[model samples]
Target: MPPAYVEALGSVAAVLTTFCWIPQAVKVIRTRETRAISLTTQVALSVGVVLWLLYGILHVSWPLIGANAVTLVLLIVILAMKLRHG
Candidate 1:
């Protein structure tokens, strides 16, 4: 495949995954509640995101870096809120 197409696909995947977190973040923020969320799941997700960020850096993947950076922020916020409220 062409570089343009590869980049486009990567960008699209990044956008979709990044946007997917918005709803969860907004819901947690608005409700200020996280009782329904599992602690194990959040921890695992945080670890996964961190690894993805590192992988992105190593690979020099802009899409991975951008997407994982935003996702990491969102996850951190949600985790904080969960700890505070739960």
Candidate 2:
């Protein structure tokens, strides 16, 4: 595969993954309640995202790093809300 194609695919994947969380974040923020959300799932996802971020950094992949970084923040916010409200 060409370098351009690889980069493009990576960008697309990153965008898709990052944007996928938008609805969840919005729902949580709007409702200001996380009672329905599972803490275990959020914790697992946060851990996974952190690992992905670390992998991206190690490989020097900007798209992965950026996307996972944003995702981690969003996840953290949701987790915090869950802990606070639940």
lDDT of each: 0.90, 0.89
- Report the Cα lDDT for residue 57, model 1: 100
lDDT of 2 by residue, 1-86 (tens): 99999988977887888878878888887888899899999999999999999999999988779899999988988898888888
Q: TM-score of model 1 relative to the true fold?
A: 0.83
lDDT (10s digit) by residue, model 1, range 10-38? 77887988778888889999999899999
How many residue pairs in model 1 have overlapping backbones? Answer: 0
Q: What TM-score should be assigned to candidate 2?
A: 0.80
Which candidate gets the maximum lDDT versus the true structure? Answer: 1
- Best by the TM-score measure: 1
